[model samples]
Target: MFQKVLIWFLLSAFFLTAWPVSAYLPSDPLYSEQSYLAYINIPQAWDIAQGAGVTVAILDSGVDINHPDLKFNIWKNSKEISGDGLDNDDNGYIDDTSGWDFVDSDNDPSPVASPEYSQLSISHGTALAGLIGSVANNGLGLAGIAFNSKIMPLRILQSDGEGLVETLVEAINYAVKNGADIINLSLVGFEYNVALENAVRQANQSGVLIVAAAGNAESDQSAKDLNIEPAYPACYGNNSGDNLVVAVSSLAVSGQKSAFSNYGADCIDLSALGEDISSLAYYNPAQGLNNYYSYNWYGTSFSTAIVSGVAALAKSKNLSLDASDLTILLKSGAENIDALNPDFKGKLGTGRIDALKVLNSSLPATGKLIKLNQSSAVYYLDSEKIRHLFPNQNIFFSWYNGTWKDQTVEIVSQEKFDSFKIGQNVIIRPGTKLVKFQNSGRLYAVSFNGLLHNADSLTLTELYGDYDSRVVTIQNSFESDYTRGEKLSGLTYPDGSLIQYDNSDKIWYLEAGQKRELTDDSLVLNGFRSEYIIKNVNSDFYYNIGRPIKNLESNIFTYFLTK
Candidate 1:
């Protein structure tokens, strides 16, 4: 027997509306009407992060891959070449350059156009995609919650908004194997299947977060108690005891649970805007509408998508965040809405989500400074997720500018603070200042990853014009701590040195014992600073330099220098 899947809420017909435009606001006409943006403090959250370098897999009907607002944000598979008719990546799928369409077992994941389903019903995934990651500030369409995140579309549901649990299991596994940081399941069913639960458990074990919709009430029937009639994957989280999934209910503009949203504190883990929401519309050729905007769409599906977008933002802010960390931070940062809805008190898990609060509750990313609440000790989390403490204020200041109270140091809870294992004490930042022993007057420059390079008198003048003020004295007992590298007598500079010659306008990256010129201008525009670049370098320094690197587009170099 086929289990009939429910789309979960009421949707209004496609319509056009206008709003007055102003400076500093999105030029998209619908942006003015999206009051939920301010309700969730999305602007404040964007101040911290715009969800870059994160991927959210949408397992829904299908997404319009060519939609103007979503095309640029679609996740691209770098390993597989398109139209090759072969599995280049050798991951069992052929020519899935963007994402797989499990419903049709094809490469294109766009919604299936059929006469069996209404246009409004088939447009489900595209609307959710818009809510999650439409291009922001592009003056074309409404902005998404995590505007910079990539959307990985995995088509599991069909045009009529119904699909098999077996297909969903395959999509979940595919999402995990393809590097999805978060999985969004906006469809709901009442049947409990073991295969689906196992897929969710496997995804959770792989550090991928799952966000699912709490089933909605029928028009003739009242909202059901999830504790008695629990939904499948949403209720699985309640039973897992580890918050393996984020089961979301719907909230109206009044901050109360939507009349159609399923309730019961046991299943619903969060709430978000689900009424009068607007997003991108599917292009239905049968209707000859050729439209691209939908207004007044209400559903637990959209609410789940909203939460998924915020989760993406949280993951982007701290790349080290696991599924458990995300669930904890989301719950801890939520604003309790029990006061607003007394009858539904405790029924709405953790009340409504606040994007800014969620980000504030998260730990800082690797290579940043962090401290535990109520403690003054600061630690630097490295790329390996190891925390290294600074022995003294002198040592701490050498690696950071300004003061500890600045945004450079993030305050985290005791649980988050203890997650990283303790490593060796933090060494001084490379290429910033020269160091000298207490007994020996000889000065040495710190290179990449703590290698000490001898800076002789002539080398000192060439590297730093004012060498006296840049030298930092260290205790004789600490002399053995540093690893001594090659002297500055060679034509090559230290590993972390930034050099620019008087004759060229090129900026060179010196790292990993090689010099590669950055070919992509956007990398420099993203975070590379000009102040750190050493200008008017001696011409002799360029003779033995490594060959220029072509098409260098990765942000690793920029992140290394900026951090």
Candidate 2:
């Protein structure tokens, strides 16, 4: 007879470098067991205000809908009927009461049973949700940054943690339409799709902030092979003035960048607590695992969720601020991480997000301020040429065939006019009158547009009006090709081209080559419907460089962000 080994768990302090396994044990749970709260500067985060009424939409594998910590915050689409097998809201989804599952063609987006990782391990989404907003100070499991905030759980990725572009787009659209204040996407891929970019732009335009994981591919420090780009969406820049997307990095106990975390000065925006962070695990009653309420994981994915939760807190306090302002606040509030390379400064953005700084600071009004560098008269252009200009003044210039055209103009005052030169920079004082110049001349203006890039060029005709407007034209070409607000139908594409559904009958196609369209019933073979449809398919090509793009089976268990 063998005496059973009685495992006696003990509790301990939650040290930055130390794993909080003991703290996670039910006996004497410590605040450090709540990774975000213990590691993150919470007193600072709360000064701004707990994420009160804001809603963060988690677009990942289906969350354990019945989790004790998450039941209260899960989004419920009251307008959409549940289990009736009918599209009640007329939004294409049928019975999407909680959320629609793109991996499986059913309304109940629960994790499936599997051997690789127990189906009970539908812990990824639940853990992510916990990071965003678990019941705080309730003397239950653990506390979340935005304990008061709500969660719109969108099941875009499957249990195996795989996702498709179509499902992602649909989830994004849903988040925007459903009033999600912040969107957390801990997924990453390489392929660039125009439709996806457009969808992100649309969401930002709608004032919803987006946060993504910076990826876990350890930084490439070799001088010859240094990697400057992190991952997609995180790498994509927003045309809107608002800073819509942020790429987050992880920090270790020694305050150094985690070895598995990815960092790009140009691509990454900020850093957050990610390594060995603890959060809720899915409940498994059958295994007598009710006591195992929390688990520790690492990756920028967790950091992204923390930032999203902070964004929710910000939104709850100030409902007027748009996505751009929120991004500025996060960037401006971050504390520098010592482990980061000096070369990454400013490039990695303002630094790691400081929750307390954002909560306590008095935010500026919604619009961004344009501060002309009064000390510097010469501004560097993309061509490496320097232009002499005055501070706080707007200018117009023309470019033809990629070369500066020799035509220019100087409108000194809003009420006064001056002769214009086509190629030279024109300086305009405040309240300047508008004048139209003939020929296809491009107009350039600099304004504090809340965009990362300050200056923009537009066509002369677009600026043709008595009153100066915020919207300026950058191109003056008069081709019959698609102009602004023009709609066409029935486009065709080649076999290998990637297609994105635009409407019932149209699709936006993209590839390395030129843009084309695919029509007829062939669209069905490629996977498209007049209405939104979700299905798991098989493809050899990786949807994302590191992950499989498509699923081979209906039931798959994948992880979202790997360490």
Candidate 3:
């Protein structure tokens, strides 16, 4: 009888034969664990997020809702029906009690038992879910950073860890609509699609915070060597909007970027824990384990989820903060990693997301201005100094001699002002001493000059900088004494042709063999060109002289010349 009972207990404990019992248990007290969380400052983060009521939405494979460590924190759609074969909430998903599974086209996303460990990778989704918001201080398993926050699992990817763009889009929409304060996207692909970009935009407009993995390709993802390249969503969404997206990188144990993680000056916005990370794994019924708890994988994907959880924590504290404002706060709260690498200073954003700093710091009403450049029009604040702007704020500026001129000359074509040459300017009212000021519902001083110009003919050098510094000039002009109003016809070059306009008519006419007229009016014939068109002329036209014209037509006419 004793032998029979022991056998029964063993059979019950080991749900599946393939589940590795040794890996699920915590490392021996005598041995130091080789995991990412072992090095992270979780205690500090806990102090801040313990009370914050943040809710993170994980859009991956479905989470194991019954997992002991995750059951208490899993978000449920109380309005939706469960297993009734009915769409009670009318949210388009049927019985999505926990989260929808796009791969199976059903709500039941329980992990399946597999003989091989590799075959059991579908457990990744559940593992990630546990890492983001597992029940904390339960004395059962490792604790997540934000232990008390809610975890909304939206399964979009399949068991193979691959998903379609359409499904991902739907998942994103659903997450935002379901009151997910922060959306975590741990999957990435090597495709650039407009549809996906629009989905991200829609999420942003809904004030949903999105954090994406920068991908695992080691080399610079932004390099031109990768043909037809561009990792989807993450690379495409960074800096796409103020509150839409943030691309994150991964830091290894040595404080260096992960070898498998992709990095680019323009692609990734920040770095976080990526290597040797520990998280929950699916229970392998084949190993006869009743519960699943394994931590053996590491990737930038996990880092992104942690950041998402932190963002959720912030949201719980201040529900009124917008996406942009929240992003600023998160970035500002990061702790600097390795004070020696100045090169990585701004490269890693404000630093790794620090939960305590974020929770304790005063919420600034001001927003941040990222990627500020001269091309950005400064109608309000024109100075080089950074200025804060509040919502619904307006910036006012006094008209200067070299400022406030129309940068675009033509209505249809894109003929822009030549920074090298003096262009048109406008004047302001009397006693309106040229003063540059920025307003975010309030006035603030900036680095712009307030000199009054004699006329609207402001030179690019004065307004911005040297014309040549803006873009390389390419010249494509055919000599002909064409009269004003007489459309210059039949001028074509290779696909990319740089044509300079010197006439006052502000129009370049294109005529094809007396059959078709292709006039390029108001030609600011500098910079790069991919296509060509003829339209009305304007004052902002420029001429380039040293570039190859991709497409050309034999018969061409020049309507006006400045000489």
Candidate 4:
């Protein structure tokens, strides 16, 4: 009798093996250990929306697209004919059937595994992808929050988890152009980058939501005050009501602020369970790449993925919801945990996210992309009931693929179009296409607020990692129509590109947008392999480079390692 009771308890209680009546309960072996799923109320949320018909762009270290739990949900570029060695989609990237790898500038976006690097750093993107959209209830490793959502793995960070702002900017544009409903940036940097800021702003304007980590605290420090020391992408629109970047911070299992989570009332827009999280594992040095599970991972990076998954749920429920609509719904549905963390009260954004609450809430009915009386003018009806016009065909095509007559755009009466107040005119989508004056020799990249930044040959190659094959030569009279921003001068090497002098033993880290020589030991410490470095470059390039950064002993090169 005792043995039977013990067997029954083991099977029915902990693992829930005996009962399969509950449709929500997953049979994955590791499902019981994924405590954060319950902490964020994902099981209940799943009943409403399983994240169908939504695409999430994971802009981090590349994901393991072949992972059994992830393979089915990996997004495919239907427009691009594979292995053709041509830009079939004409969207800058070639043969990006699954996703683009900005790190190596190739078609394969899978993480580059090396025996030299840490498994955690290399598997970062795969883990985040699993958290967002791994196959659910398949008796696999574990269920993802948005199991039915497709994942577009845009590899921005290298295998070591280090990446540059320029790469991030280009990736953001790619996500927006490729129809990513939500872009999950499970990465962070200490510096402010204008190109990255403009990229985020432009993506938000294009009806895509961006979710960024609020950065973890340094090794020797407590949680830093973001108000005093800001982190990029997350703090892009701080204190601005129009800010659409959903800056997510970290919370522990106890409902308290994770000691390492960067926080401030100004920057943090949401918080989620960052401690003791579980997800799929990719890098296994001993056994090689295999479908596996990992637990106890903690960071605002995972927290950001959590919120992004919830946002995916929201997007799946209401196909027309834009960035602003999702942000408002998330905030309104959050469960305030300030009472638990008295010291960090009001610093944790609206509060810990309640996925069920976010899903249950209704979005404003005014959201849509529409045209008037079969007229060529296209406008986006925003949450505030404002109609923002797409100034020209260039701007319209930048936001959408195919022609303007797609089913996504609603044909409304002129009176309905005029019902909403006119807001700002839509700007050309960034990083999708290049523009230039018809008679001018120079080429310019479009950014937020219609700002054009002049790009030279080196800027095109180093910053965008490609040449100008898709330049749109506009009429010279249109020059006055755009706001001119800064020019991309070749003062610094593209951020994160490796360089060495013609015959010098020294290697420089250009991630700071300037030349900073890496210590000989850093090569081994950070897993700087030979193939990744651009060797034998002329020494003359370093003539205008900035001095090496100070306090190298404390700074970790990557965010995943720091966390």
Name the best candidate (by lDDT): 1
In candidate 4, how many Å is residue 468 off? 58
Work out the TM-score per prediction.
0.65, 0.59, 0.58, 0.63
Which should have the higher TM-score, number 1 or number 4? 1
Q: Which stretches of candidate 1 lie over 4 Å from their true place?
A: 1-4, 17-25, 284-289, 363-563
User: Residue 12 deviation, candidate 2, in Å?
Assistant: 20
TM-score for candidate 4, please give it: 0.63
- What candidate 2 gets wrong by more than 4 Å, as runs, is 1-30, 115-121, 218-230, 238-242, 284-292, 338-340, 365-563
lDDT of each: 0.78, 0.53, 0.50, 0.74
What are the runs in model 4 whose C-alpha is more than 4 Å off? 1-25, 283-291, 364-563
Q: What TM-score quantifies how close candidate 3 is to the native fold?
A: 0.58
Q: Which of candidates 1 and 2 is the stronger one according to lDDT? A: 1
| Model 4 lDDT at residue 350 | 91
Error of 3 at 169 (Å): 0.7
- Whichever of 1 and 2 has more TM-score, that candidate is 1
Per-residue CA lDDT of candidate 1, range 134-212, in tens? 8877767688999999999988888887888878899999998988999999888898888888888778756688999
lDDT tens per residue, model 2, 178-212: 77888898877666666677778777656678898
Candidate numbers sorted by TM-score from highest down: 1, 4, 2, 3
